[model samples]
Target: MTDSHDASSGAFDPASATIAVVTYNRSGLLTRLLTSISEMDPKPGHVVIVDNASSDDTGEVVESFRDRIGTTIVYRRLETNTGGSGGFSEGVRVAYELGSEWIWLMDDDVEVIGDGLAKMGRWAPRFRSIQGRRYDFDGSEFYWQYRIAERMGIPIPFAPAGFDESGYKPMNSGCFEGMFIHRDIVRQIGLPDPRFFIYWDDQLYGWLASRKTQSVIVDEFVLRRTREIKQWDMGIRHMNASSNAYRYYIMRNRAIMKKYYRALGVYQPVLFGLGTSLTFGKELIRLLFVERTVRGTSNLWRGLRDGRAISRDASFRTMAPLTESVD
Candidate 1:
């Protein structure tokens, strides 16, 4: 996938963009992210922080930023923990309602290290959706190689050597961390489904955006991870040791994906089934051999069972489109 559009026509204005950050109990990390946002050279006009009913001082952290961030900060605390998916869904909706032309979405774990917003804006005239690269906590480039297996309806890893002269790779998938998206695309595809609860939501949302307009990840280092996660280095790629909860959602979300693919008239049961089985096997292998946690298998199978039920439910087949009026 390649995009030949010229991006020199105009630049994106930071003032027109709204930064949306989703947080849970990570108040310290939230502070780090907010500090970086406060230091952005051309600060965004609005910042929306969605607190997923954190038990910590996450709300006070956002309140502290009110006087320091130099932007219109909107803080929303959900009554329940809806996980990353719900936090981002609400964040995007709030940002869109605020009349922001572009929305920058991320978690509390990453800090903007450079003019990532400015860099993303450079490609706004050409691409409706864009993703920027990030550095690991140790300062190495984080692994973000991804491509959508259209027939299988899932994102799979790909080599990172195919960047265009403009320093971007056209992608059918996205990561919520530092994703710069336009409001027009949101109107077309709707908010990220909250039911996903965590995994694969961004990939499906990105694929949906790509269907509307070209989506690309620019070769720009804009974020640095603040948290250190345990992972096994597999030479070619690194695999992070995921939690049991993540293991569950990772499998269960495959069912939610089928619903979206079917709505879009591209669901192939045989191929999707094959893909799901392969995914289950890969995760099982990773858990047993790589992560050395056989106990997580229960979560995996349970997720698969529940996911099968979700696939059978008629209500899960459709996504609600966002209102066109951003009023």
Candidate 2:
């Protein structure tokens, strides 16, 4: 749990990896995250904390760890709150420019478990992009389904009763939390699109990575959620009750998502439309029954209106690759 990894140990030196975290005003949560990183076995050599123009004491919180964490702490504060998408976009770019061979992306709300980096690094030889599992606040495994319904553009929760003998499953979608990616993939795919201010940006970024290499979610447990969210317990799984801002973005981002699907030659308007409608109905039910409030419905409707405009807009585009050519 110290900054004592030997460079000659292997290709995945842990020093070659950089941890990029996007944080807002969660100063307390950020502190916990940094503490965990400081304690990680074969800890990353660099940590980039992107502050989304937090009006709170986030800057001071980061400053406190300048020399204490035993790793290079690069703190970059944005001029405005660009949400997770922008924060991560900036963080990953900074890490890449620093010449990091691998970038580990996550939010401030989670803490890395013991030797998480070491476990993730073990697969670097075989996979360029990999993901590790997480434990919820109550000690339950976080839901990280493997596949994506490409045609419908939704995550599919299908997997074997247990992890395969190989201890990982192929994944088309990516979670910003615990997504460990190699620099080659980043150069090929560019950065996470800042256009998606919040929701679904990671999915597209992950899907893009999978297009280039064999992206998979390993069975290794790497993170733990520090906060407990209010969720509606369905018989099968629990649905987290989201904020109005999240509700709005979730509805609005469908248009941006469609642009990517369209570019990939898999845009099925009828199926996508049907899926969106079902999502709308499901959210309405969640807002009414779970949250017991009708306030966020306005955001959902407004999101639909704005989403339509985005879909119709000829100017909106997907993230362009940084490299000259990509497979």
Number of colliding residue pairs in each model: 0, 0
Query: Which pairs, if any, clash in model 1?
Result: none
Candidate 2 lDDT over 15-62, as tens digits, reads 999999999999999999999988888889899999999999999989
Clashing pairs in 2: none
**Which candidate number maximizes lDDT?**
2
What global local distance difference test value does model 2 have? Answer: 0.86
lDDT of 1 at 22: 95
Candidate 1 deviant stretches above 4 angstroms: 1-9
lDDT of 1 at 37: 88
Each prediction's whole-model lDDT (CA): 0.85, 0.86
RMSD of each candidate? 2.4, 4.9
Q: Candidate 1 has what TM-score?
A: 0.94
